[model samples]
Target: MMKFIGEAMNETMKRNFSECPPFFTPFGDTHKCISLFTPIKVSWFEARMFCESMTGNLAILDDINTYIQLLKYIEEKVCNCVNSKINKQCEDNERKLMPRFTGDAETCLSILEENFYYFSDEWCTVKLSPLCMTNKI
Candidate 1:
């Protein structure tokens, strides 16, 4: 995994290209920068903490384009593990990684049901990797 160096919140800044990971793909026309953490699994709180540690936020994918692109990227990454010595294990990890958290919760105002746009809050403590975002597009 390539570590990108920079503080991105409101805007995407100009940084040294050499430090940027090639896998960090820009989603659609937004300023959001996303990277998957398939190798690490943590609870929702931990996931958020992890992203914050990197000066980012757990990708609360509210944009259709961004969400779609992320899924596609993940699919490609998982598929590429076919030749790995632990191919089955890798594929299993990918399955549990999905239905990722989106920073939403079940509140008194409303109850969120499972759907393409949102996932079950029960996954909050399920110890899984999350997509981190530097900026919300």
Candidate 2:
């Protein structure tokens, strides 16, 4: 059942990408396009792969402004479920130094619901929805 769901997600995403252009929003000094693959959760690595397949990568909130804008965007465009955690990109050293990090070797960054939707270090193997982004569009 999980494999079927995953396959269905990939097919849906591919069709969506081919039919509709991604909406780009202002991020710092450039425009960024973000896509949240929800209703299906996967590990950090899987999330990254999905984004890569779309010619993008996991979303990276580098500054407060970008973070705020993303939050607003998600609130308005995506579902309002507060229990959802979204995967994002993070550096190895950065994840390790986070206050809540457990010193896990395969930790990654995610927008944690328990952390008030803030960035938190979590095991890379943990399943979560992905927030993909691209600056090229």
Candidate 3:
């Protein structure tokens, strides 16, 4: 059956696409990881939807080092981009959420911000990142 074949192919792809250790695809192939800025505010689920709708999925922070650096970059950008107490607060909130989720969080769960990972060398090896999006939050 066509459905059966599709399912089989899906399974095959999932099996072959498995990532090793800390390396994982935070977003699918559609959306690219943005390095710039955009004040895109939405819920985590909404962010995922936005990513998918805009040709990607939610951002994923696989390690801690890159996460800390990225956090500082975002905060610095925010401090410079919009210097205000409220802006700082909002940016702080956003940074807190970035590395909150792991690759697999099927059910609603909490995250530990102490963890981090390295910079993704190539966006292609996974799926997304070329479209590094900035938050329009």
Q: Give TM-scores for every candidate, taking all chains together and pairing residue i with residue i.
A: 0.58, 0.61, 0.37
Q: What is the C-alpha lDDT of each candidate?
A: 0.52, 0.58, 0.36
| Candidate 3 vs. true structure, TM-score | 0.37
The list of candidate 3 runs beyond 4 A from truth reads 1-32, 35-39, 84-137
Candidate 1: lDDT over CA atoms? Answer: 0.52
lDDT of 1 by residue, 40-75 (tens): 767767777877786676665665776677667555
Prediction RMSDs, each to the true structure? 7.6, 9.0, 16.1
- Which sequence of candidate numbers ranks them by lDDT, best first? 2, 1, 3
Q: In candidate 2, what are the lDDT values of residues 23-116, reduced to their tens digit?
A: 3233334466666655447777787787778777778777788788777866754434343343122211122111112346788877754566
Cα lDDT tens digits, model 3, 14-118, are 632333111122222322233321344344455455455644444545556545655665555434645654344333333323222343444322222233323
Most lDDT-accurate candidate:
2
In candidate 3, where is summed lDDT lowest over 10 consecutive residues?
122-131
